[model samples]
Target: MEKKTDVMSIRVNEKIKEKISKEADSKNMTVNTLVNQIITNHVEEGTVFQDLDFTSVRKQLLKKLFNSMPKEEVTKMAGTMCKEFFKDTTMYLYGKYDLESTVRTLESWFNSSNIPFKEIKSEDSIKMVIRHRLGSNWAMYFETMIKAVLEELEVKTDSYVKTIDSFSFRAYY
Candidate 1:
């Protein structure tokens, strides 16, 4: 079934309207479609990001920082800080933190961070692969962080793999 939508009218500055029109044309979409996308994104993901006080940082800076940290320290930080971050963000976003919510939150985080990932699901397990160019330390951090989060959710992970630019793991619920 098609979802129902309500129509509302709002006034915008002429310059802003022109810019929106230009952007819509550039994207080969109608202004209405683009506006709906903007509203939906704001309501769904932007609000969560705002509430969580998320900030954007340059990828180069992040790569440098990750590279500078010792592997042991990176692992420890990921296990501790990233675990807490995932737990809290999942709870805040979903009102409850579980395997499903945590997975959803992680996907959203990856998307917002502009990271590429693939998730394959079966009846009893999920396999996630994240590809990046931030080196082995970043992969290690992700592996450790994912393990910590899954441990908190009481999910067992196996088939773990980490390379210089990618990480993958299979989690069984």
Candidate 2:
């Protein structure tokens, strides 16, 4: 079904308008479509970063930090730091903490962090693969963080795979 939309007019600087028009033409889309996409993204996902007070870190710095930490320390920090934060953020964003909200929140964070991820859904479970170049310690950190969130939500993990540059898991809902 098509979504309903409303029409409104707003003014922009002439140069900004020209840039946006050029970008829209280059992308083979109308100005209206590009503007709608930008607004939708801000409303649906960008607010999370704004409201959560997220900070940007260089990948090399994060890589060094993660690599220096012991595996056990990485696991402990990931669990302790992410569990309640994830739960609270999910609740605040979606009005409840469930698998769908959790997954959506994760996707938003991955997107904002410039991490590539793939999600596959089936009748009974959802599988996610996060490909990050931050190394095995980072993978361990993500695995622990995700596992903590799943445990808090009472979800069961069917399988988990971790490597130097990627982490994948299947969770039964």
Choose the strongest candidate by TM-score.
Answer: 2
Taking all chains together, each candidate's TM-score versus the true structure is 0.79, 0.82
Per-residue lDDT tens digits for candidate 1, residues 1-173, read 99998989999999999999999999999999999988876787877897899988887888899999999999999999888988889988889988888888878888778888999999999998888778888888988888888887788889998898888899887
**What is the lDDT, from 0 to 100, of the residue 69 in candidate 1?**
93
Query: lDDT: which candidate is best?
Result: 2
Estimate the overall C-alpha local distance difference test score of candidate 2.
0.89
- How far does residue 109 in candidate 2 sit from its true spot (Å)? 0.8
